[model samples]
Target: MNFATRPNFEAISSAPVMQRARGTARIGTKQRDGKTCIDTLFQEGCGKIRLPRTHSSALEAVFINTAGGITGGDHLRWGADIAPEGRLVITTQACERSYRSTGDTAHVEADINVGADAHLDWLPQETILFEASKLDRRLTIRLDEGATLTAIEAVLLGRDAMGEEARDAQFSDTWRIFRGDRLIHAEATRLTGDGSERDGLSLLRGCRAFASILHVAPSADRAEQLLDRVRALHPAAGLIAASANGERLVIRAMARTGLALRKLLVPTLIELTGAGSLPRLWHL
Candidate 1:
């Protein structure tokens, strides 16, 4: 074979092939023995779910990502459906970490449905982004007119104790909530830059950690009661604010570190969920 016409087998063999993690986890609940129980579960690839023993009447699920952390090109999805009159609580096994990426951004999606008179509490752990990381996440929830839902999403730029900083990072988060075909709440957040923009008064304002909490109920009275209880707690740390809109209550908080953010989040979450305590995984 002529040298010019021959394929470069050496270069082809030397080039590295990228492997990305992709997985989906789905769970559904039903009423059993007068208590909510797992009805169906499906997990594939790097996604995993566990049902730890708990004393609460609601069924609890813990999500796990076997890939360890997310980077460019990784995709993960989670879904949950609660049957009529059922109760469910969902949480992650640990905080999700987003590492540096070369090109594409990592993506995560959550879709949840609440049936008539059902309730769902989504309390995933915080997500930490390292320098140069890019992440895109979205959460969509549909509820029946009689259903209730409480959800929390928190993010940290980097760990304060580790002296890490995500000065160069890109993150986008979107949340949409609907009840009986009507959109009740919608929020979108985007952050991109060398982190200096966070100093703006309307932005994070020098805080390295932030979170959003949402609670929805059939009656405005219930939403108001939870809002009042959260205000009474008066988290000793972090800057926290709560507001009510019709049948929905929303809380926003910012802090210098993850610990301080949690101090503000825990009580508010407890009040919104009305569970008296969070999922056991939160303590671990």
Candidate 2:
């Protein structure tokens, strides 16, 4: 279909998440006969859901999910597709809190596709780990040459509001970034079912909150400029940040508490994106 002749869904103001929610985005190129596609779904099972989409560029869509809390057997699955020259940005309304596991572990999966000359940003808010809760998360990204993607995944051990700490919780996360059919980056972190301690400097450094920011830019020099600022603002405890080879930067910030980390990361995100603030739903 012609760019101007494709069906456009009405701009949804609110995303309802009962037990199941699913979304999709597709785009067609103006030339070269390229195609792009992205789809995401959330299954409540035993939790509340909140997914919202706002604003669109020539070939872009923004998504945010707020899954209040989950017990056991609750799951969320999100996927995306980007055609040649297409772009997308995805976010979450708030932290995903997994309470103490009452049954099985809550699961999350993210699948993405990037067409030639396309771009995508998968920026979800932090995930909070509650005592005794178990979670399994996986992320996979596929991109073609001239395609770009930036993603951020943050995790907070527990809620500080109730004097909760992540010391007693179990969590696991996995991430993979691909350029066309080649894997560019692979990372995994797991803490559970073992007698291993999650404290000390080797891991969280006794901090309850931690965040990771990832950026893939066209220019390595530009990415460095942004990474420099984050390093300057990082705290004294080694800052926990790093930037390596062409066009990729990762920042890790740890704080004594969740709120403290929030104060630091929020401004950093705004600076990196060159925006005053993220979408309103991001702060909710």
Candidate 3:
């Protein structure tokens, strides 16, 4: 065989680049002295949990990704079970970053089970996608009858402060939440690439940071007050909007800057669910 015309041996067997990380974490709830606690927990690989911290009456579970960030061919799985009457809050230690991928897309999946009368707050931090990155993430919640569930998902196109540009990226994020056999809320957000950011379709309207919050419970108390507060804080006419149908509340917000988008998130969450102050790691 001709040496130069033959297939390159080194390129065909690139062993190191194909290695990927996998993480799994599971948390189960229980009762102790009339208070809810994390009864059973399992963590491996990059998935980790910060021992529940005393937070008034509820327990806070802080999840950490030891791999630091995700890239092509990486997989992350997280799950939690809320016992009857258990109240728990979950948050990430810091924003998760998705890097440019040369091969397969990165994946993140979360499954939450809430028992009757149980309350769960799924508040993971933002996911930032770098230029040419590919990420597909999904979160599913199965709530028993009378269960209270709240969740927030945020995404940033690129690192705005660093003057970086996400000229090309692929993102598909989905949320499916159910109560018993009924599906109360279903949302899917997709960005095939970064071409639409500068367009004039009115969708996103050149915004780099976007967020969505879903609350399903017996009551959406102070929601009107939360709307008023959102309007007061964000005088910008259409940056934020909220709607409610009995116990289900949905809020969507976008901003040209991350600071502004967050300004709308914190206060809205505090006033809407009245879930007490933001998670401590959120401030740090």
Best by lDDT: 1
Q: State how far residue 109 of model 3 sits from its true place (Å).
A: 0.3
Off by over 4 Å in 1: 1-4
Q: Give the TM-score of candidate 1.
A: 0.95
Sorted by lDDT, highest first, which candidate order results? 1, 3, 2
Per-residue error for 72 in candidate 3, Å, reads 1.2
| lDDT by residue (tens digit), candidate 1, 139-189 | 999999699899999999887889776878799999999997999999998
Candidate 1 Cα lDDT to native: 0.89
- Each model's C-alpha lDDT? 0.89, 0.65, 0.82
How many residue pairs clash per model?
0, 9, 0
lDDT of 1 at 89: 91
Candidate 2 wrong stretches, greater than 4 Å: 1-67, 193-196, 233-240, 274-277
- Backbone clash total for model 1 is 0
Candidate 2 vs candidate 3, lDDT winner = 3
Checking candidate 1 for backbone clashes, the offending pairs are none
Q: Could you tell me which residue pairs clash in candidate 2? A: 19-44, 35-83, 36-82, 36-83, 37-81, 38-80, 38-81, 39-79, 143-180
